[model samples]
Target: MFSKSKCFVGGQIWSQTTRRITKWLKEVKSSTIRETQLQPTCSSPVYCYGPLLHTVQTAEPKLFKDSKTFVDMRMIHSQSETLDTFNKLMEKTEGKPSHEELKQFVNKNFESGNELENATLSDWKENPKFLEKIKDPVLRQFASDLNQIWPGLARQIRPHVIENPTQYSIEPVPNKFVVPGGRFMEPYYWDSYWIISGLLICEMPDTARGVIENFLWFVEKYGFVPNGGRVYYAERSQPPLLASMVDLYIKYTNDTKWLKDNIDTLEKELKYWLNVHTVDVNGNTLLRYYAPSAGPRPESYREDLETAKGNQALYTELKSGAESGWDFSSRWFADTDGSLNSIQVTNIVPVDLNAFYCGAVEHISNFYSILGNDKKSAEWKNIRDEFRESIYKVLWSEEDGIWFDVNITTGEKRKQFYPSNVSPLWTKCIGQNQNMVEVGDRVAKYVSQSDMFYYPGGIPTSSNRAGEQWDFPNAWPPLQGIMVEGLANSESQMAQQLSFNLTERWVRSNLRGFRDTNEMFEKYDCEVPGRYGGGGEYVVQSGFGWTNGVILEMLNAHGDELTADED
Candidate 1:
């Protein structure tokens, strides 16, 4: 549903569309999801309220009243002021009595249908237990630091707190997991992939296992993992990386017994992704960022509504970008305006989503082969081959020598230069002789020297100077880590060199930031390595999990090969 307002796309006035409420059916994990469409009878346009599962408003708090750990965290998010007061109160409250008193105070403020202005859920499990020994100073204690944060960031959900979006079913997830810190107090889908890398390096297999278990629980209960472990995020999913997370955990722990027990769930989850999120392009299906519901996101409502201007399609596309996890990046925009109004995310088919899916297929195929299920293994391998064949046909740009996203509607390739252009190569989708070799070659050529990409510190999200937080000048650890890993897999000397350089640059910033601030940040200012990043809807985040994860991972992966910075 789009507003009656005429929108613009590619310099053409978009056709006016109206909201049509239609009941839809879906197979959610334990609960059946029933979608209720809203149609307006009045002069105002239809403003449908998307159903949220496992939300405080939907579920009864009294159901979990008997649980000792169920401390209604939603109350703290009633308003920004209440959240500020809660954070301050938390500093004074330390014991059981204090916890109970704080709980009552929040309960007093809690009212049904009360505006939850912004639902930024954070769950920091009690205090951290310090690691007593550090054996390697050359590594600069990143692994040790992450290991310390692992326990303190653990959170769990009780069985009764389910928010099933439909009338169909309800599945329960009761497991412990780690958060990515800042306002993200809950587990995120793709963040777990990099976080598990550091967790394995730190030899904290249990915490890593807990993270995967929580996600598998989500797949079993919700049919797929949400963007993050929040009710408001149920509309869409982030990049599908649960298979990679499981691969990391099992590779490090030799936990074949657990893998054997969970292989059924793995296969089912893979089907959930392919069947549910797949886009049909000329009878060949590829993955894309998708959100089932249409509305301004509840979390960023004010901003979303303001940009949407009552256009339902634009609203859904913007929400799709949020699902991509590089939310609000200029990569999703049409041109240099860099305005949110320029976003039309649902139309593009991303390269990384396809590559990552290929990687997931490989993981599943290998897992099946390991089980000696040759027929099933071959079946999955064929599926991988079919999906891989569609990559270049749909996304590769010959003139640009880069893999770009496809505008799904117009069948046109978007040639915006993006770090994700390197993603297909990261998944080892190219080699010496294949046509994809050109893609690898181009990525190698630019990644080594692009000023827009390679900063003094590390690779920023994009070359775009857009003031958005996910754009230039902000170096995220996960992007840097992926570049290092991908380039390391390349056969070219330039690619290999770029791999080491990216790691060195990122490490310089990470080490310097830790030295100056005494804590890891969620993102870095590559121009001035120690400067905190800004320009997001919220302030700069601290105690950042993925930063700590990738820093430790890069150190472990390239530490011995590169010269160690002087301690």
Candidate 2:
């Protein structure tokens, strides 16, 4: 079920208001479960849940520092044989096997390293025409290096995985796809959007098309895409960017026939979110990120267990936070201390999630329009209009000069300085009545006046220095892409300049970090230009997918103006 490649290893609380919160959460979970039950789910024997998984992930001293390592191991024999051996060992030791004994059993039965092998890209081009736009040799070389990273991060499931499905956690895809390197071996949900964009820029549309097709395969098999290409992530999903990826692919390829073929699947995926993840806010329906699952994440079993401290509700919240793609951020914490235990991701109606929905529906509407389905096109357009209206009524804050995530539980706005607060601008979900120019100008000024500009390297994910990777001092590539795209697309000149400035800083930091370390990091220390980011569950990753994508996107957008001369 795995390929032979390289090996890299990688919430909670209560209250009296807790009673009402708990009750609401239960109702929400019940409703979501019922909705999900109507659809076919691609369940795995060992990845999502099972005795073998539980024993290994929770084993004392841990089989691997990163719990994902154990789940990712391919079995040497059939899964039933492996499980029988494990159960026999447990019975022999009366369910109290020594850590070493368990370790030995695992080593004997499973592959010793990561499940995904490095896949070479047949479409990789050494010099893309996009790079010729860069006048500066230093910047062009850096951009070239980023382009070269594509093949190394490409991965495909082993053929044995298809023959022996139960022997692995990885969901098999028919084609090779790029991964966000350094322990993130499988293809992720939203990361593919940027990866595909970068691939197209590198003149690798075939590779980009393959990744999109993999996601389409997921929607067909699972009725929705999982958070990543693993069974453990089946119950959860990251940002709803499948349609966005489709949009990007069409722009680069102009493949209307492909859109016609896959439009139904896209609608099915969108309906999954609309049916399962939507919530009510004062009678208006909006979307929120929710992962209706139990137990600590198999990938992060130990860390989630210790943080939750046996609280199942807390575990669920942690998983939901992870589903938001900003796991362990202060933006999700309910307390002022920024404690992991205080995370309340379910209560909050995230601005970015809703904005993404808005964008997705609009794209779907356009897809239908292109396919000459005027009736369905009009229907999706109406849905988009209604959703945009709800977002404007519920999430926008004229007083604060930006949109905010509203707490569905309390009906109060979370008026924090999060990069996501500007997502509506990015998604262009600023309501049908609002003037784009006026709104863009105001939002641009708001951003210009915020603490984001204080970071010389790039925009921090949030103003809070919560010691989480998604918090202060850490600037992630995806967040940078969001802010830059949001502002650059605006009618406000100041906003466009701010976008360019942020773009320049991010590209410089990535370039400097690559120059110093000879690597492209997953996240960077926004406070230190050349340093890689550190915080959260594991060591900072390298050969990152989105990082390379964002930098290449920036280079493509502003290559003529950007210079590599010492600032």
Give the best candidate by TM-score. 2
Query: Model 1 reaches what TM-score against the true structure?
Result: 0.75
lDDT of 1 by residue, 1-567 (tens): 233565332233333333211111122221112234422111111112321111211233222322111221333232445445544554555312243554464466442222112221132222222222323454445545555666555655443233421211112345566678766766788988877776777766776787788888777766778787655566678988888888888787777789889887887767666655566554456777766465566556555666877677676677788889888788888664568788866667888888888888888888988878887787677667766767766676656666788876677777766677778777866422454444556777766556665567777787777888888878777777777887777666767777887777777777778778778888888788756677766778887778878877776665555443634
Best by lDDT: 2
lDDT string for model 2 (1-567, tens) is 112222221111111121221222222442223322332123555665657677888887767888878777788888778878988998999988999998889889888544557788888999999999998899999999888888888888777778877878888888899999888889998988899999999999889989999999999887788889988888788999999999988988899998999998999888777656767788677877777566668888778878987676777788888899998799988863569998888888999999998999999999998889987787677778878888898998888678898888789998888888878888898888998778888888899888776687788888888888888888889999999999877788888988888888888888888889899888888789968888899889898899999999999988999987566
- lDDT over C-alpha atoms for residue 503 of model 1: 79
Pairing residues by index, what is the TM-score of model 2?
Answer: 0.92
Worst ten-residue run, lDDT, model 2? 9-18
TM-score of each: 0.75, 0.92
Stretches > 4 Å off in candidate 2:
1-45, 113-115
How many backbone clashes are present in model 2? 2
